[model samples]
Target chain A: MTLRRIFSFLFLLNILSCKTDSEILPSISKEDIQIKWPDYFPQPEYNFENNSLTKEGFYLGKKLFYDPILSKDSTISCGSCHQSFVAFAHADHKLSHGINNLQGIRNAPGLYNLIWQKSFFWDGGARHIELQPIAPIINPVEMGETIDHVVYKLRRNNAYKSLFNKAFMSDSITSQLLLKALAQFMGALISTNSKYDRYIQNPKMNPFTDDEKDGLALFENKCSSCHPAPLFTDGFFRNNGLDSTFIDSGRYRITNLPSDWGKFKVPSLRNVEVTYPYMHNGRFETLEQVLEHYNNGVLQSVTLDPLLRNGIALNNTEKRKIITFLKTLTDRDFIQDKRFSE
Target chain B: MQRQHTLIFIILFIFFKMKSILKVSLITLIVIIGFSSCKKDRKIDVNTEDPSIDKPDNQEKFGTVSIVFSSKAGNSDLELDSVKYTNAHGDSLTISKFKYYLSNFKLIKDDGTVYKQEESYHLINRSNGKTYTVELENVPVGTYNSLNYLLGVDSARNTSGAQTGALDPALNMFWSWNQGYIFLLFEGTSPASQSFNQALSFHIGGFTLPYNCIRSISPSFGSQNVLVTEGHNSTIFVNTDVLKMFESPHLIKFSQVSESLGGAIGSSISDNAANMFSIASIQN
Candidate 1:
């Protein structure tokens, strides 16, 4: 009778141990989470060798991205400036509005296809995607919070501690891990599912309209030098002839070279339809104005792009068609994806 | 028969306990042996040319070296925000803050073999007393003649992603908008006024070509050589004179150019700042 009781007790203990083990392991499979991009797209600059992507990490990143706790007074989050609806661009704001109603110098550019970007911001100051968030986070006009205080705040919060533990599997929360988490979410933002992409994949099933087709041809002839297909930006710094005298010497500030004056990073024309109030300083509000600037308003300077020296001549009909083509590049599914929602 | 059954039960319990103890001891023995072999392999890897390699009886082949930086202004010790010091340019200034980065340390032995410290990045801040001494461990036991280190962070680390510890961007030693570390930061107040509030700030940093301020500093030890032994720690005392920064190759006047952020001026300041460090003494 004693032997039988001991065997039953051992069996119960084994069952309980198995139950506890199962509870300890995460329910979500790591394989389910992946960074997917189009086959036609170029190799991304940021390969996730250092920071392996997982569901928990991405979720934690999403949490951090939307949380206002990153700010000094807990007022603004990354989502405040980079709203997902307009492809992560601050729509209608000429300049970024920050803490204490302070105005920033430059417009907050849209955040998408970040893994492909070699550099960040209008001046191309931030070289790495992982280090890009530090610029806005510490900017007195923006978040108005130091990274030390941000780390301290996150450590105090019980919710963040659990999330960080789940993601990094470490008891200690660090800025490296925090930045990595942020990078994971930002790098995963691959927007390649637009109507244009569909049309490229299958011309027969998803045919472009006559106007779009003409616009595509015109864009290829006129704008494809700077804004290439698949990923709209060539990721080069150039002076697009906006001003004769630069109030904001864009790339020159970083390089401190006289030749780099007025040179700003060429922004991706992807989702340019909704990401309005465009240019580095948000000088142009509509696509028509942007096209008009390219057509006739090309100001000459020492650093003006050699290709745009004799500006591309496009008629009104060509401009209209180009706008139609640009609209097809907007990815509706990316903006509405539930995984990226707050 | 009941007594025999109890005896059998006791024997079985003892047998199980002995087996478990034997298994645990076996595991422990394997772990110890594994660690010892790993340590031996690491030692061999670190110092292939060590004299102790030929004589395997000598177990301790590595020692520790500590570089202690003592900041001074002219003849007196540097005191922040209180004491006034006159620079070579004859401008009296009270230093509020002084910080700089020293990285990529390499110790050269008497035999010309170099022992390069991995990830040797240290931020020396005047406000923080703990950062004055940088201790390096696992240095091959030898007589080192000279020490070489970079006055600023290398260009590769500047471009590389988020870093921790001394190179952490949160330390405010980095420029957020420009995306590079401020290698040497000197902020103070002076009576010679041109700027607002009579402030003198020199944020020196640049890693790009032609304007790169990442200077290579090799402080001479004079006649003294750092002797590292198995059980002994060698401490090298280095004196960093702040007045040398103002007047060396270039004379920085507070009245003319009080404030300089990274550029040609910053690079020139870095050139002057490179002459600041000198080896004072070595205690083995």
Candidate 2:
């Protein structure tokens, strides 16, 4: 009778122990979310085969993007320079601000629709988006953090350990995985719900006003050769005749070819209204200034775009009409969307 | 009272037996789970390093081949900052830094079949002064007579995204401004140089038209085929003469032209890289 009592007590204890362990540490499971991109947009340049899209990875990426832990002094994040409110552009700063109050040489380009971009930055130095974070993270004037240190910091954090386990099914954090997570989050930031997008989807649903219509016509005639429709960028480097004596040699710095001098990448006109302070150096403060430059300020150089050589013949009324058309590109739904907000 | 006691004893006996059985199974389950989880972690590590680990089906047998790179200026071993080197153009130059990318290895079997190493990229930096030996594992087991390799990152990988191992951007072998690898870098001082400090730096790399600086070399083993048998180790010794960089087709003088010639100097140095390498020894 004594032996039987001992055995029965042990059985009860064993079951209770298992139950308590389960209750104390609940199972963490995350669902995989599909990336939603508009049908009109071209196929993304990034191949998803290497790192498949997963919900846990996206959320982890979003958290990392917003967190200041990636910075060297823990003062800045990718989000600091790229805010969600202004379509991820560094708003009013002509030269994008960096860590320790340092300034970058180029303007902070917007972050959405990046999957379609073959390269990154104003000069398009970074070939892949997965590699793009390395530039800002290690740039001495930027976040100023080493990839090894960032990985070490993430490994030390308890929350990140579990998050990485859930996302990658392993607690071990690596730079490749970190970059993959960043790519997942950045790739998911697809903006295809502007008034223009709706008009493209169904013209009757959201028709453009008369002023916008005139502006679109003028833009098609003048600007569409460089800033094509849909993606809004032809994805080529051109010297838009911004300067004759190249302070910043632009593509020439990369290619080292004299012909590529002053040739900067043709930027997309999407979200142009909100992403103020335009061009590679962010020299123009307003749309009017940009038009005025194209109209008169074009300095002739050997590498200048032949299309803009004669200058874009635009008067005050035409500039206003073009500005109204550019305003339609501002996607309010994307900027105010809570999915990307901190 | 006697009948109740017998019934209680029987019930207690059954409960005891059931408890023992449950406890034994639980422990076994835990042991199995613990072992499997450990194995899963190890597998993840191996998979990231070698993707071929998962798919062993229809795989060929392979062995490892290690290549050692030794730098020399003429007949003597390279001594950085020694100021004891002379170029073809009769200029005295002292090499302070030397680094280059050795990639895209191809093994030529006795039957003339070629086998390319997967993810074959290595950066050789003399400044770090470590063993410049790179071990290429999982090469198909066979007799290889000659091997061909490129001195620069290919155009395909230059345009591709972030790479791992030696090609990792963290290694600092890449040019931040140019979207390409610095195929060969040589920095030193010369009395005849135009710079204030008499410094000479040449960074040779470009993938664009008219200046594509990637160069390849194939070194043959005389009268012997390198046997790469399964479980057998092999080493190939390749000697590099830094003099060849400034000699032959283009005689680069420190006084005439130094510093980053963009692609101008790069083009000539790349052409001369073909004659810079020779196989010293191959042991099976």
lDDT of 1 by residue, A183-223 (tens): 98888887889999999999999999999999999999899
Across B1-284, the per-residue lDDT of candidate 1 in tens digits comes to: 23433543564455455665564564354345434444554455545588755543455488889999988887678999989889888988999899999999989999999988888999999898623988888888999999999999999999788888999887989888888899999999988848899998999998997789999999998888999999679999898888788897989888988898888888889999999998878898
lDDT of 2 by residue, B175-267 (tens): 655666788888998898998699988888887778889888887688867799887778998888888998989877778787874476788
Each model's DockQ? Answer: 0.29, 0.25
Give the share of true interchain contacts found in each model: 0.52, 0.31
Q: Residue A205's C-alpha lDDT in candidate 1?
A: 99
How close to the true structure is residue A94 of candidate 2, measured as C-alpha lDDT? 87
Q: What is the TM-score of each candidate against the true structure?
A: 0.86, 0.82
- Cα lDDT, model 1, residue B242: 80
Q: In order, what is each prediction's RMSD in angstroms?
A: 7.8, 8.1
Q: What TM-score does prediction 2 earn?
A: 0.82
Instruction: List residue ranges in candidate 2 displaced over 4 A.
Output: A1-34, A152-158, B1-64, B127-131, B136-143, B222-224, B227-231
